[model samples]
Target: MARRDFPRRSDPERSPAPREREPGQTSFLGRWLRRLLVWGTALTLLAAMALAVAVFVTERSLPSYERMKSTQTGQTIVVRASDGSEIVTLGPSYGRWVPYERIPQTLKDAILSVEDRRFEDHWGVDPVGIARSVWVRIQYGQWRQGASTITQQLARNIFLNNSRTFDRKIREALLALAIERKFTKDQVLELYLNKVYFGGGAYGVDSAARKFFGHSGEQLSLAEASIIAGLVKAPSHYSPTADPDAAVKRAKTVLGTMVRANKLTPAESAAVDLKGVKFASEQGQNSARYFTDWVLPQLDLVLPDNDQPIEVWTTLEPAAQHAATDAIQANVPKGAQGALVSLDRDGAVLAMIGGTDYVTSNYNRAVNAVRQPGSAWKLFVYLAALEAGYTPDAKVKDEPVTIDGWSPRNSGGTYAGEIDVRSAFAYSKNTVAAQLGNEVGFGAVANMARRFGITTPINTMPAMVLGSSNVRVIDMVRAFAAVSAKGSAITPYGIRKITSTEGEVLYSHRPDPVQQLVPNYVAAGITDLLQSAVSIGTGRAAQIGRPVAGKTGTTSSNKDGWFLGFSSGITTGVWMGRDDARPVPGLQGGTAPARAFAAFMKIATAKRPPERFDTEVKLPQWQLEPDDESMQANPDGYFYADPDGNIIEPGAQGRTPSADSVVPSGEQGVPVPEGAPAAAGDDFLNRATGRQNEPPRPKPKPSQSPKPN
Candidate 1:
C-alpha cells in the first residue's frame, strides 16, 4: 500500500505530533514549587525550636525566684516626746517571711476570691481567663479585667516594666512558669500577699491590714481580710481615708464573691457587715507636722543611711502640743494669727503650734514666718550691754538724742527721764535700748545675736536695739533656750533615736550644744533682767507662779505681737499677727498671746517643780565719777558751765566720790565735784588718755542694733 500511498487519503503524512519536551524541562515549574515548599517548612521548624529553647532558658533563669523569699532591711524610727510618748514615725521596715501554711486562711481565701479564682489550677497561664478578659475588655471598650493570674501578677510586680506590650506579656508568661516550677503554690501565694502594694505607703497585706483596720493581718476577720484584698487593685480609690463608701462597697463585693466561692459560711455571709470602715484623717495626725517637717531634712543629711527606715525619738510632748494648739485656737484674737514654739533648755523641741489650725494652714509660722519682733528684740541689746561688763543696773540716758539724724522715742511716747538697765529692760524702753545699741558697736550687737542662733540676716542698724528685726518664733525660742541652758547654745533637735526592725539602734540623737556666745554669768545677768520683765514688766501676762524670764514685743502699728519666755528647764516663744503682715486691730504682746503662753505653761509644768537659775547673782553697784574737766555742774552743784554752756572738761582726779561713801579701787582717783570745771592743766582729754583712760576707739554700740518694722 505504500507504493501507491500518495494517492490514499488515510496513509498519513504524519507531521509527527508536536515534539515532546525534555525530561528536566517537562515539569520545571512543579519542581520549583516543591523545592520552595520544603525549604519553608524546614525554616519554620528551626525557628520554632529556637524559640522553645529561649523560652525554657528564660523560665529557668528568672531573677524573682532567686529572691522570692528575700526580705528587705527596713528602718523603724521612733520619735518620743519629752514625756516619752511616740510623736513621730520615720521609715519603719516591717517584714516577716511567713510560709503559706502559717498564713491566715481568710487572707488566702480573700485574695484568691478577689484577685484570681483559678490560682491553684493554672500552670502560670489561663487561656479561658485570658479569653474572658479580652472579651470583657472588648465589650466594655476599656481594660476591665486584667486576667492576670497570681503568677502573672507576681512576675509583673517583681521584675517587669509597668507597661502593656506583647513582648512584656510574653516575658511575664515565661517568668510565671519559672516561678511555679521553683516554688510551691503556697509559697508563691505567700510571696504575692506579702509583697503586693496596698496603698497608703503600705507595701504588703500585713501593713495594709494594720493601717486600714488597725489590726494585724493574722487577726483579720473575713470581712477585714476581703477589704484588704480588694485594696490591691486600686488602693487610692478604695482607701478608707479617700473614700470610705467605695471601700465598703468593694469589701461587700469581695464578701459576696467569698460567699459564692464557698469560702464563707452562710451564717458568716449573713453576719458580715462592712459598714463600719473607719478612716483616720490623713492630715496632721502626727500633731507636730511643722516640727517634723523642720527636722526631717536635717535628719536625712545626718543619718548614716537613707534606704533603711529610722526610729527618731523626738522631744515633742503630746499633751503640751495639744495644749499649745488649744490655746492658739481659743486665744487667738479675731483677725489675728499666731505661732507658739516650746523647747527644752538643751534645744529639744517640746511643742510647736504653727497656726490656729494646722490642717487649714501649713505655713509653719514657728519656723517659716519672719515678722518684726517689736520689743522682743530688746534682749540682744540687753545681752550686748551685759557682755561689755555693764551691770544690769547701769544707768542709761532716756532723754531724746539724735543719732545720725534718727530719733528714737519710748514705745508709749513718754520717757522715764533716767533709768537703770534693769528698769529699762523691764519697761522695754525703746529710747534707752537705742542709746545702748549705739553706745556698743552696732556690729557687736548683730554679732552677738548671730552667735545666739538668730539665723535670719540682721542689719547693723540702731533700730534693732528694739525688736525691730524680723525673726521666726522657732529661732527666737531656741535663742531664749540658750539662756536657760546657762549660755550653752544648742541647735534645735526633734529626733531622739533611729533603729532597725531587728532592734539594732542605727543612731541616737544627743544634744550638741556649744558655748560660744555669752558667758554663764553674763547670760545669768540678762536672764535676771528678763525675769524681772516677766514679774512686773511688759510680759506680766505671761507670768506663772514660778520664776520666768522673757521679753515682750509689739511691731509698729500693732501688726505683730510676741512674748518669749523661759523657765529653768523650758523656753517658749509666741507670736501673734495676721499672715498677710496686716495689723490686728488691738493685738499686743501682753494680751491674748501672753495669756496663751501662761495657759500652756500652767499645764506643761503641772507635774514639774519650779526650776531656779544655777548661778549666783548679786545686784550691781553703780558709781558715776565725773572728772573735774568733765563735770557739768558748778561749785553751787547746779551751775557747771563752759563756753558752750555744756559740761566742761574735768581732770581725772578732779572728781571724787561722796565723802560718806568709801571709794572702790578704780574710783579712788576721782576728785571732781558736780558743777565744777577742771583746773587749766587738768584737761578732760588728758584724763580720757590717762591710766583710767578709755581705749583708743570708743566702745562700739550695743550688742544688738534695733531694726525698724
Candidate 2:
C-alpha cells in the first residue's frame, strides 16, 4: 500500500534468476507434445479401424464354412485296360475321405508332434511359433522352420490357392482364423487329414495309407503312421514307394519329434521299427506304366479342353500287351532296340511296345520312329502292280535292272531269272520290284501307298521300290490292317471311349462306314502273295501254325529289320534296329523280326480259329510268245511263256511249243527276233497285255518326299 515504505529488497542480492527460456520455447515444447499426443491417439484409432476393416474384408472374401466343408476334391483320372481292369491312376487323386473319429490316434499324434506341436494351445496364427521361426531363419540365413499350423494348412488348401506371396499369406492367416472360429479343432484336423496331398497321386490320409501300406488309415501302425506323417513335408521325396530309405529316415525323425513332444515315450519311440513295415508292392504299379504313358497324352485328344477327371477305356488287351512285351524283350538281340504294334481288323490298337524298357527311353518308336521299310515297302509296290491289272502270277524279269542310274539287285545278289510276281515279292526281289516300279511308274506306287494309309513321302526314284523312304510302324500296321480287313480303309485308333468321373460321355469312337481302300481282288491277291511269303519264302519264320500273311524287310547294310504281318483277326508289325543306325552284324528281317512276330502272333491269335484269306481271284492263263526277248535267255529253255502270255518261239504249227521240244538258245544278249515285244519300252502294250515290261510311267507331279534319315 505504501509505495516507499518497504526497503528495496529486489535489488538486494536477488537469487540467480532462472534463465529466461527462449521466446516461445516452452510453448513450442508444450505445443509439440500436445500435437504429438493428439496425432498419436488419432493415428492409433485410425490404424485400429483400418485393421478391423481389413479383417472384415478378408472375412467376407473367404469361402463360407459350409462351402468349404462341402467342397469336392480334385479327383483322379483312371485309365483302365480293355477288360476294365485298373491300369494306373492319374493325378490329382483324392482318396476316400476319413472322418476325424475314424482317424488313427497314432497318426494324429505323429502329425501333431511333427507338423504343429502347439496346435491345440495356439490361436489360428501362432505368434510365438512365428517369432521362433523368424529367429531361426535369421540365425541360419535360410528358412529352416515353417510356423504354419494344421488349421492354416487346411485354410490354404481349402480356401486359398497355392501361391507364395505376402497377400496370400495374409489371406491364408485370415482364413485360418475364420476356420478356427467356425469349426472345432477336431473338425479342422479332420479336414486337413482328408485334404492333404501325399505322393503317388494320393490326396487324403486314407489314400496315402493305402498307397504306402495298402491298408486303411484306421489300421495304421505306429511306424506306418509316423512314416505317413513324415510325407507331409515333401510327399514325393519321402514316399516309401519311391524311396524307402529316405522314408524310413524321415519316419525316424518323426519318431524323435514325437518323443520330444511327449506324445510317445523314448522307449516306445525307439521300439518303432520301420523294417517290419511292409510298403505297397510296386510290381502292380509298374505293370502298365508304359501303356499308361502312351495313353496319357491321348486323353486330351479324346477330351479336348477338359480339366475334369475322366476314365479312359483304351483298346489295350492286357494279355496281348504282355505277350508283345515279352516277345520283344526275349527275342530282340542285346544292344538293339525293337518295337511291336498290334491292331485289330477294325484298326483298334490292341497292344504296343514302344521300346524294350520304357523307363530307359520314352521315345515311342511304334508311333514316332520312321525307318525304311526295306522290302516291307514292296507290299505297296505289289499292291500297285495288282491294281494296274497285273496278276500275282505275272512273270517279272528278276535280272539286273537300272533306272535313272540306280541299279537294284536282289538281296542274295543272285537273280531268279524270270519269276512270278508272287515269287518276286515272296523272295523280296529288289530288282524285280524295281522293274515293277519302273513299269507301273513310281507315282502310281506312291499313290497306291497313300491309299493304304502310308503318310510318309514317296519319291519317284526306283530305290523307293525297295522301301528307300522311312515309314512309321503305326502307318505300316494300318496299311496291313487294310489288307486284313479286305481292302477296308483304316484309321487306327487307341482310345475306345472316354467318360468323365461323373460318367458323362465325353467321346466315343464310332467307326466310319467301311469303304474299300483297295479293290477286293487286289487285296485278295496281296493276301495270297504275302501268305506265300510266310509259308515258303523270306517271311517263313513268322509262321504261327495258322494262315498268316506278312513281309520281311531288311535295310541296306542290315541296319534295320522288320516284319509286318497279319492274321484274320489281328495285324501286327515288328521292327528291330540300333538307335545309332549301326548295322547289326548278321541281323536279318526273316530271323529275329520274324521270330518275334511269330512269338507274339501265336499268343495274340490263340483264341481265334485259323481262317483262310478271302477268295482269291482266278488269274487268266498267259503264255510267253516266241517274240518275247526275256525268253530268249531262258536257261530252262524248252520254250517259256513270257508274263504277257506270248510264246518266245512258235512251233511248226504255230501252237504253243512244249517245254520238252523247244531248244534253248545258246547265245547271250541276243537281238530280239522280228515282231518280238520291245524290252519293257512299250507302255501301251505292257498295260494292255498285263505284263511287267513297260518303262516307268511319266513322272507325275513331284510330291514332297519324306526326308531321308
Candidate 3:
C-alpha cells in the first residue's frame, strides 16, 4: 500500500523533473571553484613574495643614509683673467647652501604647484600621481609625464646615477621611501632645493636665484620664484640667460598652476609681472665667449681625468677684449663682418673677437678663416727679398709687366717707375712686388711665410707676391709677432697656467725653444719698411700716436680687407669682409680695417710707453749700390726730372735718363730713335723733355684695376 500511494517520489512529467544533469557538470563546477580559489591564493602569495624580494634587493643596494648626507656636487672649472679675476665658472658650481627655514614660502609653494602638488600631503611615493602619469603616458604613447616627486629626484641625484631603467626606477622609489623615513618633510625639501641642478653651471636654488635674479633665495618674488621653479624640469632649455622668452612662458605656466592650486589668486597671478622680474646683468658675464670656447677644448690636455676642480689662468686681458669688441662693432659696416686678434710680443692671445657678436655668429674668422692676405702678404715677400741680399734701398722698376700671360697692374693703373724697395712697399706697388718676387723666387717667399708660422697653403706663382694665397688673421699676427720679437719663432697661446683646486700644477706653458725664424737684420729691415708704411703708405690710417709697423691689404674685387700691425708690446690683425666673399663696395684695407686696428691698438698700448721699432740694420755686400755714375743712372728712365724738362747732366752719382733713351716696346734697354714723336699720354716727358707741353693724363679711377690679389 505505501508503494502504491507513493505519488511517484519523482514524477518527471508533472513535477517538472529536474533537468537532466549534464554529465559531470556539478563536480566540474565544484572542482573549478576550488582550483580557482587555490590558484588565486597562490598567485597572491607569489606576487607578495616577489614584491618583498624586490623591496629587499632595492633596500640592500641603496647607499648609506650617511653617504647620502655627504653627497658631493660636481666639480667646477674656474677660468680666470690675466689679472686673476674670475671671468667665468666653466663647470658645475654650487652656491652657498640655504637652510630649510631660510627658504621663502612663496618659492616652496610655487615649486610644489609645478613639480609635485602632493609634496606635503603624501608619502614619498604618490600612487594617485603615478596612476595619472601612467595613464598619460599610455595616451600620449611616450614618456610625457614624470611621476617622480621631488623626493624621488633628490634620491636619484644624491645616491643613484642618471639611468633610465626599471631597476633604477624601483631602486629610486625604495630610496625615496627610505629618505622619507629618515628625514622630515622640511629636511627632504631642503635637500632637494639645495641639490638640484639649475643650469648655467648653477647647482642649487640659491645659486639659481643669484644667477638668474642676482639675489638670494630668501629675496625671491612671486614671479622670480615661479621662474626658478619652472627651470627644475629642463634647466638649460628654460634658463633665463639662454632663452628668456621660453623661460617667461614657463614661468607663466607655473603661475597658472599656482592659481589652479589656490596658492595664488587670479589677481595675484595677474599682478605677477614677469617684465619686472629683473634678471642678472650680463655685464659681469663672460664677455670672452670666443676665447672661452677656444680654451675649453684644450682643458682635457692640461688636466688629468679626475673629479677635482681646476683653475685655468688664461692670457686674456679683459680691457683689451673690450676694446677689440668695441672697435669691431663700431667700425664694421652693417652688412660686412669683422674679426680682430691681438697678441702680446710673446704670442699670447690678449684679445680675440671672433665675430661681431658671439651670440649671433661664431664663425671664428681670426683663427679659422683663410682668405687672401692681398697686399698685406707683401711683408713675407719683402722679407724673403731682404734675406736674398736685397736692401730696403735696392731699386726696382714699378712698370707694366706680365708673367705667363698673367698681367697684374697697380691698383690705380699708374706706375712709379724705378723706386726704392722701401718706397715700393710703402705704396704697395704691385709691379715692384712682382719684379722682386721674380728675382727672389716664389719658393723662397713661401718658405719665409712658413718660417713665421703661416700654415695655410701658399701658391708658388708670381701672383703670390701680391697675397693671392689664403692665410688666417692669426697667422698674420703670429708672423708679425715674430718680427716684433726680434725674429724668434712664436707659438700663439692662450692658457698661461693650469692648476688644480689644491694648488697642484696640472700644466704650465713652457714656451718652446725659440728658433730664429728670420735674421735680425732682415727683421730690422722689414720693420723699417713697415714703419715707413704706417707713416707714409696705405696703412697711415692705422697709425696711433705711437710708432706702428703694419701693412694694408685689399683683395681683388675688394672682397677682403686686412691690416696687420704691431707695436713694441702687442701685435694685432684686423680683417673685414662679407662671409659670402662678395665685394664690399668701396672697401679697402686702408679704411675700416686700418681704423679698427688703430682703435684697438690705442687701448691695448695705453699703459705702455711708446717705443720705436728696431731699425739698425747692416746691409749685405750685394745690397750695396755701385759708385759708377753710368751704372747708378736708372736705365729705365725712372729718375727725378729737372725744372727745364731737359735730361739733367749726370752728377757724380747719376742722372735722370733722357727722353731719347726711353726704351721702345718689346725692347730690353734700346734707346728710342732721335725725334720720335712723344708717346701719347707721356706725362713723364711733359715733365722731362719740357717740349709739347700737354695736360697731365687724367688720373685713373681708384678701381681702374683689380687689387693685385
Candidate 4:
C-alpha cells in the first residue's frame, strides 16, 4: 500500500520498462533460441552417426573382388559336333587372356560408345550419367535409361545376381566405387572385355569374337566390333544366329552411337560392313545344347581327370539335331512334352532332343526318361514269335478272346476274324498279340527285351507282350538301332573323341566287337511286319517317301504315345507324353508322334542315301486289303491327311488307328482301350505308365524381370 502511494499510481497502459540482460544472463526470447540451438546440434550429431553406420553395413556385404578379377575354374568342357563345330560349353569358357594393349581399338571404342562413354574419365560410376538417367526417370515416370558404368556392369556380372531391388542398387554403387579405387582405367576395361557374357554361351570378348567372327578379339573389324558391342545390351534378342535382321539393326545403332561419341567418324561408321561380319557356321546353336548336355557327364568315364580344359568331339550331327528340334517345336502339343533320339546303324547318336527347347528344359529326356514303349513294345513280342518259328503268313485269330483273368482289346473294337501275323501286326490286333505272347511265353519276350540292351527291370507279366515294361528312350533307340545294324548288339554313344586343350588325345572311340542279339532271319521277319504296318497300317503317318519300318505305341487311356523306327540307316525314337505321366486325351502314337518322325526324317534323310529294308519274309495277302466300311467312314477323320498329301497328325487327330487299318465299327459302340492291362491268361503289353530309373526333371529357375536395355 505504501509503495502504491509513493509511486504515483501507474496507468494500466504504462508498465515498467524491461531491464537489460546481464553478460551471462539471457532474456526469455534468448533462452528459447538457446534451447533450439542445443536441439539442432544434437540432431546434427545423430545424422552423422547414422551415415557412418550405413556406410559400415554396406561395405561389409561387398563381393570378393579379388576372386572375380581372375577367371580360372581349373577345368572347362567344350563340346564339339561331328563336324568340329562347337555345340556347348559345360563350364565358364574364357578366351586366351589378352592384355589391354593387345585388344583392338575398334572393339574398345565400340564398347565405350554404347556401354559407357565417359569410362575413362569417371572413377567407377558416372555422375553425369546418373544425373541424366534420374532426369529421364523423372520425366517419363519409368526407368528408361541406365546409369551403370563399365565397372558397375563388371561387378554385377561377377558378384551379384540379376535381382531388381533397392538393396542391389546400393550394393552395385558401393562395389563400383571400390572397383574404381582398386583398378586402373585400362585394367577395368580389360576385365570388362574378358569377363562379359555374350549371347550363345560365349563368355568373353575374345570368345565372342572367335565364336561369332571366327577370329581373335585383336583382329575384330569395325563391323564385327559393333555387332559384338550391340550384343552386350541384349544377348539373346540381338544375336546374329537368333535373329540376323535384329542383329544388323542393333549393329547400325551402335555405329551411330560411336559417331556421336566422337569415337568414330560418320564416314567410317557408314563404311562399316555389318554384312561382312561372318559368324561361325554353327557356333553353339541353341538346339545343340541338348546334345552337349548329354555328352558332358561321360567325360569322366572316357578320359582321366586333368586340370586343363577338355575338347569333347561328339557324334551329334548338327543338321539332324536342328531338324529334330524344329520338328518337336512345330508339332508338340501345347501341354505335352516330346523327346527324340536319333542314332546311326553303328549306335552313334546323331541327334537327341530332350525337350522343345534347351533353354526351356534340360531334363535329357532322350537319355534319362524311361516310359512304356506302348505298342512299340510289340517289337520284342513279335521277335519272340518269329524266333519261335511263326512266319508272317501264319494265321492268328483276331476275334475277341478273354484269358484267365484279363483280356486285352485292340485299338479299334472291331477286328478281322482271321488274319495273318503280318496283318495282325499291321492292324495292331490286341487279341493276336496276346495269343502270340501266350504261345511264345512271357518269359521269352522279357528275355528278348533284355537282350536288346534295355536296362530297366522287366518282369515276365503277360501284359508285357504289349510293351508294359518301362524302357529308357535311349534303350529304345539302341534296340531299334540294332535292327538297323542287322540285329547286332551295340551301345548308343554320343562322344566320339576327347582331347586336352593342349592338343593331346585323351580318348578316341574304338569299335567294340559286334555282338548279335537277334538272329538276322528273325530281324528280317520283324522288319517285314513293321514295314507292312507303315505301308498300310497304324504307322502310315510315319511314311516319308522312302522305306520306313517302325511301330506305333499308345498307352492305355492315352497316357503315352511313341513312334520308334529306322529309315536310311538311322533309328529314331519319339516319345510324347506329360512329364507327370498323366493321360493325354486323344493322343495316339500314329498321330503326333508318327508325324513328327516323318517331319524329322524328311530332313534327316535328305542327304543320306535311301536303303531298302530286308524283305526276305513276304507279307500275307491280307496286308493290302481294302478299307472296310468303318475305315472308309473315318479315313480322313483320323490323323487327317491334308489335301497336299501332308499328314497333319496333331494331338486331336484320331480316336483309332484310322485309314485301311483296324477301325472302330458302329456295332461296337464302346471303343477298345489301347495298351490296357491284360488279365493273367490273356495280354498284350499293358504298357501302363512306368517311369523307373529316370532322373527327376530339373526345376526351372525363376525368371528375372526384364531390365532396360
Best by lDDT: 3
Give the alpha carbon lDDT tens digit for every residue of 1-709 in model 2.
Answer: 7567766566547678688777756677889999999999999999878866766776676666456644655646877789976667776765556778999999999999999999998768899889999999999999899989888898887767888899999878877776777678998898888788878778778868867887778899999999999999999999898899999999999999999999999999989889899998753533256566777787666677776667888898989988998899899988999999899988788888888887778778888888999899999888877765677787778899767788877766898898898888888888988777776677878888888888877777778888889999989999998888888888888788988655678899999887777657778899989998998899989998889999999998989999999986799999999989899886789999999999999999999999888748654333222122211111232433446433333232333334333322353345544444322324433543577665545434435222211
Model 4 whole-model lDDT (C-alpha atoms): 0.77
Residues 1-709, model 1: lDDT tens digits: 4555456455467646788887767477888898889998998899778766766787677655436544343554545566644454555324333456766898899889888899988988788899999999899998888888998988887788669899999888878877787678977898888778777766667656666665556777766777788888898898876788888788888888888888887688768767754554443453477777777677666674567544566678888888888878888888778799988766778888887765777778889988888888877877776765567766776778677787888866887887788898888888888777776656767777887889898987666777667887888888888888877776777777765544577677765636545656577788889888888888899988898788888888889988898875888888899988887887888888888889889888888899876535442222122111221112232223343223433232345423322433354466645544432232343453473444334423555343322
**Residue 264 in candidate 2 has what lDDT?**
96
lDDT of each: 0.72, 0.79, 0.80, 0.77
Query: Per-residue lDDT tens digits of candidate 3, residues 220-246?
Result: 888888999999989999999999999
Candidate 1 CA-lDDT value: 0.72
Q: What number of backbone clashes does candidate 4 have, counting pairs of residues 3 or more apart or in separate chains? A: 7
lDDT of 2: 0.79
**Winning model by TM-score:** 1
List candidate 1 segments past 4 Å from native.
Answer: 1-52, 59-61, 64-102, 131-146, 276-287, 308-313, 357-361, 393-398, 417-419, 500-504, 513-516, 618-709
Predicted candidate 4, C-alpha RMSD: 20.1
